[model samples]
Target: MDVTSQLEWHPLLRDPTGRRTVKPRTRGQTMVIDKGLGLHAFEDLLQTSAPYIDLLKIGFGTTPLYPTGLLKRKIELARQHQIAIMPGGTFLEVAVSRHTVPEYFDMIGLLGFTAIEVSDGTIEMERTVRNELIRLSREAGLTVYTEYGKKLWGSTIDAEELVETVLLDVQHGAALVTIEARESGAGVGIFDANGECRDEELLDIVGKLPEPDLLLWEAPQKQQQVHLLKTLGSGVNLGNISPNDIFSLESLRRGLRSDTFGLELSP
Candidate 1:
């Protein structure tokens, strides 16, 4: 039952874009948001699409709700597949609000999480606090992925401020900074109220970033995914992907889907 040992059809067809990298990739990373999938469903996801996933986030304040054994097993499974697993940033924000950051980091280490998301989607976080959190996460032996922007409806990106955040975050050892596009993928970050991408705004942000690959755009909807892929090239890092869309998103990245059929991904 070792899926990794099995032959893949990809070799036969040859990805049309010819730029998709294997797992443990530095770019083109796909981060899946697990709202609350049971053990079997989680395992099934890894068995089938582990190759396409780089980060597995146990979505928003739902980690503590799972039975301890189940949560640990899920983390173990993800580690076995070489996927970095972490609790969602919202949960961490709760810890921050309660002034229980020590307890949070302790529990995260005990639970076997390999990563941490430093974000302030719903809370107010100063740059100093954010930098310390990123430093703390690294000190705890965890990979840091920071998120920028608010989760409120209609929140949009400020190109100048975002560039500053990304620069400082990387300087502080963040692996990638994610743009917030809540699970709804509407009226947040680069997307408009209709979940359509505001191309000009998105481009402006990208144009300002010194390292675009250091960002992970949260595009949960298929249309949003297609738009980002087309606009940013197929190698852009993406986050907040739903579990069901793993293979579908991979298809889009490979130019195997109609929307991105002729897209050329960067090598």
Candidate 2:
């Protein structure tokens, strides 16, 4: 039904944050994680919300779990909608740990994925190894997005290390650097055990980033999303969003909800 074209709100009550840039958007980008959605569900998601999603991640080593055909179809569907699709960084980390990087790239290519996530969350990766992986992914014609921070419980971003990592990653041609807040969004990265954002640490990391907009915060919780949107501006890039929350998050970004109503107003 041409969802992107048909979906619209009344003109008078325009988005308070202004018109959202359509697909190929640089900012105000939302990246959603797909743990395991069936074909129908996947299609429905794109039908209803593709325009709001810039990236779709097949979460955490689940790529191989899907039947080869299904995985290929999912990748194809996302690209058809102009969305960059990739397996979660954990899958690539597995490739690194096993020394099967060539196979990894070949498989991703065979599956028709449009992007790759380079992360060191679960394993130790040397800077040289990381840079080469990013470069190789780009050489494979995949958009590279790298992730920072660990996957351990209570992991925190080191301000100095984060600045170094982001700079190095971008220099190697990464599309964006994601801060690793695991799916739980609790006890990891910027969020605490209770899924509450550690404001001081968040501020410290942001202050150190030379290009803050190139960072993608993995804020899976609604409260966390609201806080980041308020603090980072409506145009902030966010990742790890659940499929159900796409519309809800869009509403928040546009200041349509009570939590963010009049947020973009000059008052």
Candidate 3:
């Protein structure tokens, strides 16, 4: 039986966002960034939050820091839960910087990762190189999720450039394009230095995007998630979520939380 089918909530108390598409969803997706967790803790997160997680990112260069067996087991666990797993783009950026892109791809395949995050946050990458990386990831049977924007403090969205990048990325077979807000969700991409949304910039980017669904806003903070959810609607794809915030974010999405309670009364 579907786990949700076992729920017995009264109709009036049901999820305010209505029914979210279950696993294998193409939208309203949540990507969790796992900084570091022991095997037991990882298992607990999966057990409690698997149904709500669409992707698990073993954040940054922590991939090689894990004991090989533990890392592989975590990949396997994510696979079993129908969630995609990938190393953070910073690791790939390092490979790009080190001229070890081939080795990086090989390691990803060997590690049994089902996804790849192609980002240019820290390094400058040509469009041709970006296209090839996306293609290579796709050829390797990995789901390719590319990211837009820079990681520098006070970095902000360039709406026109963003549209161009998103168009080319998805055209080259990238699955989704994440907007870089980093883990802190402050002073980067669409956010201001204080971790607040620069609403004008956000609106500009959204208005200019050819396909808004393809952009996964990296809103790691609770307020950022709420802002994006309210501004972009509940169907927005959000990335860089901390594992502990998955259920809370879902509540906000479903209008089960006070921050989004108005959704409960919407027709």
lDDT of 1 by residue, 1-267 (tens): 988787676662668877778978998999999998999999899999999999999999998999999999999999999999999999999999999999999999999999999999999998999999999999999999999999999899999999999999999999999999999999899999999999898889988877899999999999999988888889999999999999999999988889988788852
In model 3, residue pairs whose N, Cα or C atoms come closer than 3 Å (at least 3 residues apart or on different chains), thus clashing, are: none
Candidate 1 Cα deviation (angstroms), residue 225? 0.6
Error of 1 at 265 (Å): 1.0
Error of 2 at 221 (Å): 0.4
lDDT (C-alpha) at residue 266 in model 2:
22
**What ranges in model 3 sit over 4 Å off?**
1-7, 11-14, 264-267
Q: Global CA lDDT of candidate 2, please? A: 0.91
- Give the per-residue lDDT digits (tens) of candidate 3, residues 145-187: 9999899998888898999999999999988999999999999
Clashes within 3 Å, all models in order: 0, 0, 0
Q: Give residue 119's lDDT in candidate 2 (0 to 100).
A: 94
Clash count for candidate 2 is 0
TM-score for all models, in order of appearance: 0.95, 0.94, 0.94
Model 2 TM-score (2 dp): 0.94
Q: What is the C-alpha RMSD of each candidate to the true structure, in Å?
A: 2.6, 2.9, 2.7
What candidate 1 gets wrong by more than 4 Å, as runs, is 1-12
Candidate 2, 1-267: lDDT as tens digits: 789998787753667767556779888889999999999999999999998999999999999999999889989999999999999999999999998999999999988999999999999999999999998998999999999999999778889999998999999999899999988999998898899999999889888877788999999999998999888888889999999999999998889899988665221
User: Which ten-residue region of model 2 has the weakest summed lDDT?
Assistant: 258-267
